[model samples]
Target: MATTNKTGAIGPVPFMNDGSAALGVPLAGLTGDDPKLWVRFYQGTWVLATFVPAIASIQQSFRPRGGDVVIASIPKSGTTWLKALAFATMARGVYPPDTAAEHPLLRLNPHQCVTNLERLYSAGQESMIEALPSPRLLSTHMHHSILPSSISKNPDCKIVYICREPKDMVVSLWHFCRRGKPDVSFSDLFEAVCQGTSVSGPFWDHVHGYWNASKANPEAVLFLRYEDMLRDPAGNVRKLARFVGQPFSPAEEEAGVVAQIVRLCSLDNLKNLEVNKPSSASQPFANDWFFRKGEAGDWVNHMTPDMARRLDAIVEEKLSGSGLSFA
Candidate 1:
């Protein structure tokens, strides 16, 4: 039998590492070459992350509170930016632009503002999360299948999922992982991504799950593209505001609420903040490394035309008949 923690859930280490108890291989370290072979599969497509122990804490324990908002994305797909936008849009009335001193965004990193359910559970903080007030802002990188049934089935809970152009995502993920993994070579990273063996991959499966779900349940899941947001931020911000049940009133729009929010959360502005600079253990990244060129098609600089074409073809094949396309 699997050992249980004090909360009566399976212990994070034993549950995830037992092959008889979980599907997929469990990773022992950070430098795995074949993530498909190293990471344990749970709920469905989500691999039990190497950094966490309590995959079952979410599936079996987490209960969604109504009006909860979740920001979902594969890593490096504009997660931090979307968190800022979502928080600003929802809290606009409470934290008007002129009230930056009182605004949480000014003092806290985006990751701190939006809690990650999996991370919280992994750290044995489920009770703390449950104590948070209604409309709690949560973030998750888990695939939809792995999310607790409480979240997926809760009509009142809203999920906003963002995906980036696959080529750009691949390049960005490679560079991002290198922050702590100096030994990882670009060639290995490229091959791992192409073969769908990187963390939280296969990439096609991860995004398409939300794409199809959004089509079936538009009211519950809002699918977004990172490049599309960059093209027209204010317009996209309005759309996001509407989805989260916080539509900006006519007067608020006239007062430039959308522009102010975007400016405050812009890459250039966020990169210069002191909260983001603190090299803390809790921060996802050590510094503003997450702010590197938020440009679309930046893959062109690093990937050969042939390299781009192959990844595109794989994405095309995987997303075929799904009625989804990323720029």
Candidate 2:
């Protein structure tokens, strides 16, 4: 039986570390001061060490059905916002994004509505995933290179990946991390990101893995930029619905369904919901932690001119030949 935590969510179960040392899944200790941030080097990328076992299990056990859609991204890169948009897009038929009074999104956090795939596996709730009705909506921070063959190789499974410019992502991540450990210096986090040791990082590699895949198989992988979404959300929502094989009908479009969805999932609308508000005593990070300044270029407020140029140069160098410029 899966244990439930104080927040009424399934609790994570401890995984047994058998003498599988010969498997070559070596762990990387990035921050000796904080074991929580330690990572494991797997398949040429760094992932949080705590999630290695669950990732392994997911690789071996997950069976993707034809309609499964995975929302993929690096952390703090507008994941919550994308989740809201995608969920609202996909479930619009049954729960009208504009008209429904009891839509699941209105009452549940986006994370609760579309749970992270790794978290479900880690919590011994894989059965919950299997039980959920299709077409299922899932999210992940894992690099595309490391996803299971059932998902990465399956032509039937669709991946919608969103990424932000490295500068803004770094700023958003630092603020999110500081929510738990208020004393963690921004410089340390920034340095960890620069060194490619931050969780699910080597930011360039993480972004390129999907960028290249989307280029290779445009139909299966939909690559979106956070800045682009911010600029034209209604257009993106239509694009999202179309990619997931649920394009809006002419009647629905004429009725302004697309505009309604864009408004329903807007950051301001979601951030203010009671379900997303913070309750410090009960939950370590209620949905509120995910709702920060949802604007691009906020990095200028936190990072100095030199820091921005340094990170931008590194990103430019790494992504030079890939045709995936953040400039």
Question: TM-scores of all models?
Answer: 0.86, 0.89
Scored by TM-score, the top model is 2
Clashing pairs in 2: none
Q: Can you tell me which runs of candidate 1 are displaced by over 4 Å?
A: 1-38, 43-52, 278-284
lDDT of 2: 0.80
Query: What do the candidate models score in CA lDDT, each in turn?
Result: 0.73, 0.80
**Candidate 2 lDDT over residue span 9-64, tens digit each:** 33122111111111223223224445445577777877876678888999999998
Clash number by candidate, in order: 1, 0
Best by lDDT: 2
* Candidate 1, run of 10 with poorest lDDT: 11-20
lDDT of 1 by residue, 179-294 (tens): 75666677677777787767777888889988988999999999999998999999899998788777888888788888999998888788778876647554335646677788
